[model samples]
Target: MSSKAKLKAPVAAKKPVELIKHADVRVDPYFWLKERDSEEVLKYLQEENAYNEQMTEHTKVLQENLFQEMKGRIKEDDSSVPYKKNGYWYITRYEVGKNYPIYSRKKETLVTAEEIMFDCNVEAKGFEYFKMAGISVSPDNKLVAYGIDTVSRRNYTIRIKNLETGEIYPETIENTTGGCTWASDSKTLFYTRKDEETLRSDTVFRHQLGTPSTTDVEIYKEEDDTFNVFVYKTKSEKYIVIGSMSTLTSEYRILEADNPKGDFRVFQERIRGVEYGIAHYDTRFFILTNIDGATNFKLMETPEAHTESSYWKDLIPHREDTLIEDVDIFKEYLVISERNNGLNKINIKRWDGTEDYYLPFDNETYTAYVSTNPEFDTTILRYSYNSLITPNSVIDFDMKTKQKEVKKEQEVLDPNFSKDNYHSERVWATAKDGTKIPISLVYRKDLQRDGTNPLLQYGYGSYGSTIDPYFSSVRLSLLDRGFIYAIAHIRGSEYLGREWYEQGKLLQKMNTFTDFIDCSKYLIAEKYTSNQHLYAMGGSAGGLLMGAVMNMAPELYNGVVAAVPFVDVVTTMLDESIPLTTGEYDEWGNPNESEYYFYMKQYSPYDQVKPQQYPNILITTGYHDSQVQYWEPAKWVAKLRELKTDTNLLLFHTNMDAGHGGASGRFDALKEVAEEYAFLLDLEGIKG
Candidate 1:
């Protein structure tokens, strides 16, 4: 028998489950796959995994070569630019050959002896999958609290360590969001806990050092399932704030850091469709909000004594073209990160009204953002800058003198790699609605804009999250092999401003899919690539994009990759038990509502799958994913396998021991990337 015939695809049993809602009866044949722990489900997943292995067996050598090439470009013995916080110069460095970071701090001076805090390499020794997050140091600099997740499901266990004594305490807080805020007293901390079933961060608790987590006091509980709660200390270190936020509205409660046992007071009441963020500075709180129909957002401020919306006065009035993305408060200046004309800008304004200017940037398609500036009393404002061709550089700019220093630039160790060898540009593609969508592209300078060149287009146009054009060393594997990379700034993203995002969500969500299709057509029409040489990629919600585009315009691409894709929109949205469903109603709309139900069914990838010749495709998912459940893609692949007419490649990979983000090890994550790159390259007949 032929090798392809010997390795047959896994056929999932069709156990029809009728989902009735709003007078709509949708019959789901592979709904039984959601029963995660069932023996049948595990067996099917294993069979599919086995089949994927057999189908890709020919490319194992290429995958390994790609991994090594990518790994070689990274500087393994690297340390991040240390930023001072609370009298300590904190630094995170990685040792050569180590898979995790080593956190340490210096006393007062950068040259002082390094005091190692937590060596994640040592902490992650035995676990198959491990992740550590939210390492918070106490005000006194003696105690530290961090969260650890061994299961890869995102629910972390809070652990305390004595930095002075180098001893780990026995107390453990379970099922938390892996973040905590310290009170003035080093003995006390406030943290947010997640619900066991839905994994929603809905409750905040105050815990005392050396006490059992069971004795931790429940400070507040969010009764609304559609909102999530988090606890954090303001940059001013004056208040411990509890923030409750939904998609469209937010409310905050604050208590003085010195008053750990005192009752918290509400900062502001939540109003529907109003979203605001608070940044504390001295006796005043700066607010960034969409109040009074500031669609692109505006900045306001209120006295510390009067914490209400009525007390808010405009510090920077609403501008039609600018979206106030964020504000970083310092002792003498307010740094504003905003987006205008699809470009990122950092505006520095002096409190005394002496000077106000934006940091100059000349790149056509680049990303620049405020980096870590923990100290409130500094003239230097640190930020990072990068582009499709430029390596990432961390810079510190003096707000007073306007002088800048490049602290460090990413070191791509590949001897053949050079930024000058690549060219980057931004081009606009006309969408179906006559809207101009920007597409950022980078290719080797030697590349010709001919139809023979291969091109890979990527996008993530949901949740107003703008996927900026940034540098990547791993991408060299594709570019060096004669491939052009492009990022389509579709409407769902806030690339052009808040209005761009508004037009791409809710009932108008089809614009996102159609916008991507238009971008692909533009690239083809421009002769940068032909439909036979074009490929597409996206993960998470972008993975949803991949699925939708596959159904809408499969003929436009030669291959596609969907990583942990959210394909079963109608079913996942209707089930509130899912981790992030309830909180995302403002994003994908509530499918329980008849209008949204019918609207989602019209474009929902799984529901819209039809018998057609699909391009070569690969779908990746994690067994322990807390975000998009593994079954969405599993059932999606099952349905596609049953209905697809062509015998083109259809591969499904499940990271058995990982979750939404995939493998925890630094090198291990690269292996997944290497596999993805290999798949794309193999389809193009490229071999090392």
Candidate 2:
């Protein structure tokens, strides 16, 4: 990159605005940036982008090289492992030069002729950003209903097409959630619609083929702003289920798939703090829920006729250390996905209790989860496995024979790529509260323990989402460049169990930030990397983590990257109009209350910006991001530029054509990764 030292940062004009909530007064100088599409906001964003471009001009070739290096590792002409569903084998493949996937299917046998359902490359020709979701084929396999989003804002337009005639129906449904569930007759489908303003999926609609979407009947509407509703057909293909859920509770309604025009009856009323998920198996429904204070969740089964909690009987009791994640029911076997301590475990049990066993996985830090097993009568169960140093492998295990076959393993095409060249391990860091936080690390075998090597730490602790140690081809660029990569499995995520997540959210949110800081300190103390060479990165909620960490311990890192970050916590939570605000109150406490307002104000990234020296920071956001609005990062950068004492590089880049995810194309997205890596590498004066 150019001598960033010579470049001047863009100055965003101050337009102070006072926001009062819960008797608290706050002055925001750059709140004007939140005015979407306004001339002033547009100009300021453009100027910042221009500044970012100029500052990193010298890294143009390096960026391209990194992009190509990462792209080279991917098998360009590759097809996913075909899985059978509803008498057809569905396959998703990509051409050598195409940036999109081509969806196709075959008849009962693999030798049958292939029928191309959707070639996204052709559909994406005119749009800078395009996404296709919810490709649901009719029960008879004659018609397909899908949702298309050209603007990348998560709002889709649903359309239907006849597979045999290759003609699209005239009806187009707008503002949908991009997935539809087909009924037995193949003429009726159920889809969820989003509220135009808040973008919340709040209503489910039933659409009849050959009819206008305007005339479609509303099946159900979620009255609570905190909840969202979705419709889906069970794997058993007998029931169409409508699920309404929030951060803490869930409710479901079911109707026979054969009775498309029938009224759906509630299976179980939603109770506060009681979350449950149902799976159909012949005469019973298997539920995974945290009922009766089972915080880690348990598996229960009840007759299809008696689908209330009162009739529910425990099939697999909850254990304090193990969290039952999900279940897949088969005719002869029952599969349970669980997490114990910090690792994923898959347990298989026979229906008659003849055989019960857990799939054995031997790795210090790896991820394993059930893949597609849509057919209920099949004895084979498919699951995926991968680790920091291992490529993903799709394995199929026969429940009856107790045997497994490797269906397909992800191919890393880079000639120099070899799993043996890298080493991965799990280590624990002690937190301030005497909690042990797990850190997963991967590095070259010839690494030195002397703190001179550059290190990049990554973390995202929010929403009870577990960030497992999965392999990434793009990450190889950093490892090859003499950098040590670490993933901090801190609090706010269900890495250990549900309790781990509970201890890190709401009032206990500070634990997430402190756990990360403690992990950094442990790495430095162990001589893995010094403070001068240490760096951090995260995106979205993790981006929130990056913001909080830099404010809490800026001196511990040489640089940081926050992507589509949710930094304005207090201001966002106070406004229920924002897309995710209402739904996330249970995750991040509602700021309307004085208790939460004061607590959130303490750590909200934008609120905590002060006149302090910070590490070189890079912030990225998308203009059309409906989840984490683009203005969060824009206002944050403006505030940091005004308050930070050091002249360290602080760059912001906004993708004009994309949403929370920067770019739509596979190769195009790598360019963003290249830009991020180039920024970190350029700071260390490392160039190829």
List, residue by residue over 265-307, the lDDT tens digit for candidate 2: 9999999999999999889998999999999999999999999
Candidate 1 structure quality by residue, lDDT tens digits, 82-148: 9999889999999999999999999999999999999999999999999999999999999999999
Q: How many residue pairs of model 2 clash at the backbone?
A: 1
> What's model 1's lDDT at 199?
99
Q: What is the lDDT of candidate 2?
A: 0.95
TM-score of each model, paired residue for residue: 0.99, 0.99
Off by over 4 Å in 2: 1-3
Candidates in order have lDDT scores of 0.95, 0.95
Could you tell me how far off, in angstroms, the CA of residue 122 lies in candidate 2 after the best superposition? 0.3
